[model samples]
Target: MDPHNRRRHPTTTRLPYSLGCHACRRMKVKVLYPRPHYRHSLIGSRQCDEEKPQCVRCTKGGRMCPGYRDANQVVFRSVNTEFIPEAQNSHLRKTSKSGGLLIESISSTPLLTQPTERWEAKAIGHFLYNYSLAPTKDSPGYLGFLSDLLSKEPSNRQLKSGVLAAGYASLANITGLSHLKRSAEKHYGETLQSISMALTDPAEASSDTSLTAIILLQMYEVCYLREMWQSFHNDHSQAISDITLVPQDPHDKGLVELHRLRGNSPSRTAAADGILHIIHGRLHFNSVGGLHPSRIDAELAFEGLNISSSQDELWCIMREMSESCGKIRAIMSDPRRNMPESAIIQSFDRIFAAYLHLLRWEATQSLTRSYQSYKMFSREENDTHQETFPYKYHLFKHIAHGAMWIGFWCTTIYALQTLTRTSSLLDVQLLSRGWHQWDFNKRLRDAIGEICACVPYMMGDVDQLGLPMVGKEGKAIGSFFLLRGLYVAICVEELTDLQSSYILKTLLRIAHVRGIKLALRPRSRWFAQHGIAT
Candidate 1:
């Protein structure tokens, strides 16, 4: 048996031995999509190369897309991988194996240009590792036949492209093999350690190490989010002292304009002066305070700031209220969860107001104008001309971030407002009024409506919102986010200390049973639009 036929792992594709197989040329199919020219479409196609686009199968099928089954008839085979150094050692090791970049490589040859079967094999390994829909395997088939047939000397470079492809595959939620997470993490960590050097000497990072870092980073993020939710309940007790909050730079959230109206920073004042005079032609309540009151409406950006300021103030007030009643925060009293449902709803109402203000500010800045959800990036990733929405949901981030921010922000506001007064620590306000009067959910719904109205227009649908798209879909999803905000408000505030601690776990159990979870690469971006049925 040829040692070349032995596989590190048995997959589906096999490599070539001894530079043989004349019909390997016949099997070498150049797969182009609707367009005959593959090179031209590489740069022009708005959809990602990975995304199933309008290929010949779909073009011929008419109106319907080619499903995964149709992918089989697509007819393509990647080359052998594994022994990268042997191929790179020679000029013949140039072409790539699978995926769009593989297609791309054919047009642009590598620095070395002895186009031989070795290069084809190693390139195939890189492609299968990076972009193969299935995990790379050992076979004459696309899955695993390569390691068995292709014979070459050992090369670390061969693994470079392949490892990165593996990362992309994993991140996109396709397991080349049913890899154990902990084992994958451990093995992947070695890749991370080696890749750390790449940060200092980035050029040394071939596609392999760079991709490993990205995947590792993604894993870290996923783990971190999960831990955050687990630990978020106890967050109400986690305090941010007045001294801790570094007076935030306005640009931190990319917030604009209000600092100038208030005349806080010298640099901001300078920028404001020009923007007022040149951009809006109005400069009254700012440095030059003699512009007509009638001209106040002229500066759209400033008006947005004014509204945003009010919202912030509202959030500050609500945060204080939630802190006072939160099961985690109300620990001064025993059993720790004496607050009623009404109080929680009231807190939510104010928080909802704050969220509305944030959205307005975002809209004014043109941040949330076109974005739909972070989960779904535009098909035209390179199209810089497009304007996507900035994701700032009803004044919150992940549940834990929201909790910490509210806690942190409210604590600061409380300290700032009460600097002169001292005895107000235990003071509780019993509102005779009801949550219905405020009805902040309605306000949140409207804000969502405005954001949704912009999505279709961004998606190139200029007509009003409609079903299956954004109009009805938008309302349903928008209301869903609004509901979630309310639910979090409920979760954070309506609990005993015991309840707060287990609140997340309990919700997870319920959600698990009800199947109200986002899929593998979960995101909150679509949460609002889809109402958790996402």
Candidate 2:
């Protein structure tokens, strides 16, 4: 099959349906438009371009101007620079008010491009910029033109995704504890605005929007929680002087999760919940310091799980899941989770479905259905108005196998704040090219395997043009799977202080050859940390 034909297939939206193939999947591809090269448009020189792009602003005063001129040529030449200004394609010129020669808008948003698989590296840049770095105004798709390309009368030549997603990611990337705190606050407002939009869309709204809104709200909640803890820390300097640390039990099986995933049964001997047990036992960073008494209440109440673990530098390989009831597991029930990705992406759709039910005074019924683990007993009272969905909505089964992939990305972002450059973090599994250690590489491969496995489900037939699962409803199924791959690749490539950048770059090269959507959120949380307020 011709690689180009695969780009427009509908099956691309859902994960694999029946068989799994070892294929290099694509996430996004960016095509940088060439400059007009007309004397006046000289932006700046390459050396001065990293902090400032060579745009009209930099070239305002010409040769005698203080800053270097001819800067916008780009610090690196990676995209297809060949210009095809042939007469037939001239319409693109009129759209941009130039000779069909328009510069891509500079927004901090990471926009995915067609044949997305090609630009895997950019995705990593986005992950690092959005989650690891401090916030800056331009840190997130600071290019500024990304969001404008997503409407009814979308830009004829504009290329990118909406501002919110990319912008939100950027705010997460900013560095510095103090600076990060402020970026979170400012972004909280933007997220609040998105929330407001979801609240009003009675028919236009679906499970995806509502859930994402709630998650964003939670992001704010987390920031507030951190602020509260920081305040407490400032007020109680000597409260933890006598903290007693405990050691994890070497023999504890009942403490394990109610049911182990995939394998293991009641009779199977299991490893003690050592991770949890040890975490609970430790009282201080160093044994000499002992443990703080204030944390004891928090610790015991946590039932062996530590709050610090939430902040633990996230590693790709997990022996067992953190309380199955936490975030990712909690989100699997989202109505949008069942919805197709092509329909419209609602990163928090699961949460939205739950919120809508809550709004109608049916919080239990709503949240119950949306909760993946919410198991209710069959009762005669089941016959209620609860079964009905507004004319615009339908009960859709959210994809499962695909979600594990998404879980990985969400997990990565959440972990970035935790794993520091010096922590005993093992990020080698993040390698995109391939790792050689049998066990470690196996872990990474398993994650990628799940992602590629879902491709058939999203797009359906490798031969079909329209993805059957997506249908005319505007939803695509496998999006979560692909995003997961992008998320992990991005983190491994750029976010984590991983030493092997080349592996991810190579994986992206494979994506380009295979033809997948390669995209990045240009404006990330980093800029918010660097330039904006919380």
RMSD of each: 21.5, 27.0
- Candidate 2 residues lying further than 4 Å off, grouped into runs, are 1-213, 216-398, 404-436, 459-478, 489-534
User: Per-candidate TM vs. native?
Assistant: 0.26, 0.21
Q: Taking the tens digit of each residue's C-alpha lDDT, what string does model 1 give over 1-534?
A: 789977655233233421212222234423322334555565444322223444433344354443332222222433324223344433354444554232222323243433334333333443333221211121111122223222221344323333433333333232323332333345445555655555455344423224323433432332222222232234422311211222322221111232233433334322233222222211211111001011122223333221223334433444333333232223323554564655544544443444344345445533322232323244476777734332221222122222222322222222222211211221232133233322333432333333322222222222232223334211111121222322322212212333222323323422232222221112222222233422
Give lDDT: candidate 2, residue 515. Answer: 21
Give per-residue CA lDDT, model 2, range 454-491, as digits (tens): 34333232212222443332112233224334434333
lDDT for residue 224 in candidate 1, whole number 0-100: 20
**Lowest-lDDT window of 10 residues in candidate 2?**
18-27
The 0-to-1 C-alpha lDDT of every candidate, in the order given, reads 0.30, 0.28
